[model samples]
Target chain A: MDIKAYIILSLALFTIGIVGVLVRRNAIIIFMCVELMLNAVNLLLVAFSKMHAMSGVAKASPYFASDAQVFVFFIMVVAAAEVSVGLAIIVMMYRNVHTVDVNFLNRLKN
Target chain B: MNLTTLVFILLSVMAIGSAIMMISSKSPVHSVLWLIVVFFAISGHYILLNAQFLAIVNIIVYAGAIMVLFLFVVMLMNLNAETEPVKNYRLQLVGVITGGALLLVLVSAVMKIDVEQLVEMKVGDQGLIKVLGMNLFKNYVLPFEISSVLFLSAMIGAVVIGKKDETANQ
Candidate 1:
């Protein structure tokens, strides 16, 4: 397993997600971009979990090797929750303003 | 060089390409579809890494549930046509520039890391559901239950926010 390659791939995906969040104005798309970022992190963590499992020091105990995988599960749970709340917020925004664009959400400004 | 490496490269290309298209696509629905492609590619990677459990969950949670949620919201908004508002070039340029800089910095840092004592992969069944379930239920039970609470709160919050107020209707 070329760990470097996995890391690079994960990083590239993360970068694409960053660009998506930065460039998009649509609230739903922006939320999707955040999900993309979360998936990227999940991929990297899985790769690291595999790497740790392969290392010699951790050969005896397999539990330490798979800890990151469990962490990824929690991340997925949090992401699911976030999606529900975020979509609801976007829905509420649409109901009040009649659009899902984030540009009109500058009411926090002075 | 080997088959696994080749497969990894192929999946990586698919993932990155779909991701780029997801952001650049003119329609939000298309973006969601592209994002699904990316998720599938990532799931393929998980399979390649021998993590079948995660790969399945990725498909079920992300592509099945979350993406359908996105599509439903888009459909509800009546944004079938290309209706996104146009923004100035400066904001986009700034976004692109920042993203590019972040990529460059992270990639360079990644390349500099030297792994002198890396071990060969054992191909153990660590990614299996049985092992992960035991670990999750035994050691990580608290976090798991707390996450359920988080989900409950999120469900309530979504319902509260999405429900139409009767006072505003009249």
Candidate 2:
């Protein structure tokens, strides 16, 4: 595998997430974009994990080969938890504002 | 290109395309569904990388659970195009410009990277469930437990924050 391809793919996904976050008005859409960014990072980490396992230093211990993969697991865990909280917050916001438009929630601005 | 590269290209296009559609789609429900397609494409990438455990987990956590939560919230909100306020086009133009600039900066930075070093990289069987499980339980057990605590707190916080107190409102 040319690891560069994975890097390019991840960068594309991250850019998409960044664009979504910047362009979208809906709270749920922005939240999904954040999840997209998280997934991009997860993909990069897994690719690096495999790359490192193939390299020299990880020769002594196989455990080190999966280190980055484990980080991906934690990321997925945090994402799951964050999705629950974030969606709940979005739902609550919709209840209060009657719309999921993010621009409407500037009441907290200084 | 070999089959792996071909598969990689297909997954990449699907993922990036769906991600774009997810943001542009007017309906939040359709956006959520598009995001699910992105998740599945990412899972396919995981499988191609030989990270089967992560592939399955990606499907379960992302495609299964998180997307369902998003769908539920969207439906509960009863949001449609008319109900969904449209943002000013000027703001959208700026968003696109900024996003495009950032993408250029990042892609340029990545272009300078020395991928030749990684070409010699060899993958072990560590990505398999058995190896990953040993690593999780033995070396990373503390973080594993810590994540559970994080999940518990998130659950409590979501419930507390989302609860509608009718008496207080009345």
The residue-by-residue lDDT of candidate 2 on A1-94, one tens digit each, is 7777788889889988998888888888888889999999999998887777667674777577788888999998988899888888888887
> Which candidate tops lDDT?
1
- Model 2 stretches astray by more than 4 angstroms: B119-123
Question: Against the correct fold, how does model 1 do in TM-score?
Answer: 0.95
TM per candidate comes to: 0.95, 0.95
Q: Give the interface RMSD values of the models in order.
A: 1.6, 1.8
lDDT of 2 at B4: 77
Q: lDDT for each of the candidates? A: 0.87, 0.85
Please give the distance, in angstroms, between residue B145's alpha carbon in candidate 2 and its true position after superposition: 1.2
DockQ of each candidate, alpha-carbon based:
0.71, 0.72
- Residue-pair clashes per candidate: 0, 2
**What lDDT, from 0 to 1, does candidate 2 have?**
0.85
